[model samples]
Target: MSRVKFELPADDLTRATAFYREVFGWETQRLPFEYVLVDTDGEPVDPADADGGISPRTRFVQGPVLIIEVPDVDEVAGKVAAAGGELLNAKERVGEYGFSQYVKDSEGTVLCLWQSIADGTAAV
Candidate 1:
């Protein structure tokens, strides 16, 4: 089955991080490019267990996104387009992590596709 990863939009990283940290006791890690990673607990998410990561809102990401992990981003993207969905952004490499892309399903809901690297350290 395809894995589902949830993403919440954050307009203010500092404020959002603090809120989650205080309210939920979640730990936050600031990645390069001003993106903040939120862990529900202090422990790092096991690659085999994680559903997704939290980050700041981007131009292509206006609201919450559900990232679905796949084996091949390009193939899935083509399938999305062929199924009457539209690609919101081209596939992008997240450093050594993996490749990802955004798409709007037939219902106009924005979703993300994540393809992990060989090391399995990719972010969704």
Candidate 2:
């Protein structure tokens, strides 16, 4: 089954991580490029949990975006326009681990699709 994750933008990493820690009991770890990974379930973070990254608020993402894992980024992306959604950008490599792309649904909700490196298909 496909896994779903959420990505949220934060203005402050230190404060944001601290708030999530204190309020939701979620644990967070700092990542390279000033991103933070939040473990909403309190589980020890796995090495491949890059989808949970909380990045600084940016022009493309001023709010929360859902990250859905798929088997193939290009295949799903090809259906966006026909489904009445707009492809925000083409898929780009995420550290040799996966590819990520942004899209906007018919209802205007922005989302990110992630295709992870296959272990024949890795667990989320």
Candidate 3:
């Protein structure tokens, strides 16, 4: 699609933000509710094309799980299972913005699947 955003889990927001900023030179914004937004200053690239020293083979489970936009969370979740992957949880509403679900591929790399809900209604 056009854009993709990644969500990283951190126990210490301050420390994590500082680490990214100091180590990688990424600009970070401390948002409300202890959420620190990291600006990578570049579009999301495929692991295969990334040259930040992370091997593409382990990139899926190494750090931040990639968030890919999809049209239907449920449909993609079903496809994931059919393709030998496992869903970590059922699709759920994302604060009226969309629905999301965590899934692990056959290689055990967890990623998030997101589907936007245009009408603000929960999608079945």
Candidate 4:
């Protein structure tokens, strides 16, 4: 399971939901602020179980991006810069739980790096 997730941009939640529904066959459920949860088709995961659910603990940003995990954020941050992708933010610890950062690809698309409590490492 990946520690990271992606949220696509939407100008109109209902219109976007309908489009994605036809395009990907994914069911979107509304939350607050016109945000929708992209429904997964597999068995519903329970957050109470260790490896059964989405990390209810991690924070997610609202935008279309890739989620990656890595062992050390500082190391990856350097690599991102060296690779010509600009690092948008330094790694930030969210309490004792995990850390995250933002970066932009060569085309300027933003991507997020996610680290979780389980491995204390960021996902790539």
Each prediction's total of clashing residue pairs, residues at least 3 apart in sequence or on different chains, is 0, 0, 0, 8
Q: Which ten contiguous residues of candidate 4 have the minimum total lDDT?
A: 48-57
Instruction: Pick the winner on lDDT between candidates 1 and 4.
Output: 1
State the C-alpha lDDT per candidate: 0.78, 0.80, 0.64, 0.58
Measured against the true structure, the TM-scores of the candidates, in listed sequence, are 0.83, 0.85, 0.65, 0.52
* Model 3 per-residue lDDT tens digits across residues 71-105: 88888889999999999887867554567788998
* Off by more than 4 A, model 2: 49-51, 119-124
Clashing pairs in 1: none
What is candidate 2's lDDT per residue for 1-124, written digit by digit as tens? 6789988899997888898889987877776666787887888666477438687887768899999998888878888778999898877876546788999999999988888886635432
For candidate 1, what is the lDDT? 0.78
RMSD of 2: 3.4
Among all windows of 10 consecutive residues in model 3, the one with the lowest summed lDDT is 48-57
Arranged by lDDT, best first: 2, 1, 3, 4
- Give every collision pair in model 4: 7-63, 68-123, 68-124, 69-122, 69-123, 69-124, 70-122, 70-123
What lDDT tens digits, residue by residue, belong to model 4 across residues 68-95?
Answer: 6665677777888988898887787754
**Model 3, runs deviating above 4 Å:** 1-4, 29-34, 42-62, 118-124
